[model samples]
Target: MSLPDFDTFRAAQAARGFDEVVARSWAPDEDVATHSHPFDADALVIAGEMWLTVDGVTRHLRPGDRFAIAAGTPHEERYGADGATYWVGRAEPG
Candidate 1:
């Protein structure tokens, strides 16, 4: 689904208690092999595109697109032809 602007996304994440927030960028055709995070997180694409695969399913994400991943869920990511930049927010465990 589409996401709000970067500032709004960050504010929402903060409001939701996401303690770790950062901006990340990927180069053209960059690929991240299967991996998992220790904490649940959400990402909001700010520029270019990304192809994200979670549990073997892939979806295209463009600017303003957002996605969430649960802790420990295996996933892979590939940047678009022109690469991408996004903001990620990690939630603290209760």
Candidate 2:
């Protein structure tokens, strides 16, 4: 099956109580040091690839892959040579 489009992602985000929906793109071979966000996140890899590290486990993410991170979970990110573009939904802690 194919990946969902921005419209589909937006609808899901709204239904899931994610008040913010953003499109994020990383530069080729970019590396992000360990960090954490203030809100929960749900994302879909729509282009290229990325590595997501959370709790010391690294996950290779590709197009159509989905991942989620709870608020304040320390994590790291690395983008592949072609970089990556994703649609992310963020929900603040209630």
TM-score of each: 0.88, 0.97
Query: What is candidate 2's local distance difference test score?
Result: 0.96
Shift in Å, residue 16, candidate 2: 0.8
For candidate 1, give the lDDT.
0.89
Give lDDT per model, in order: 0.89, 0.96
The list of candidate 1 runs beyond 4 A from truth reads: 1-7
Off by over 4 Å in 2: none
TM-score top scorer: 2
lDDT of candidate 2 over 41-92, digit per residue (tens):
9999999999999999999999999999999999999999999999999999
Write candidate 1's Cα lDDT for 3-72 as tens digits.
5766777888999989888889999999999999898898888899999998778999998788999888
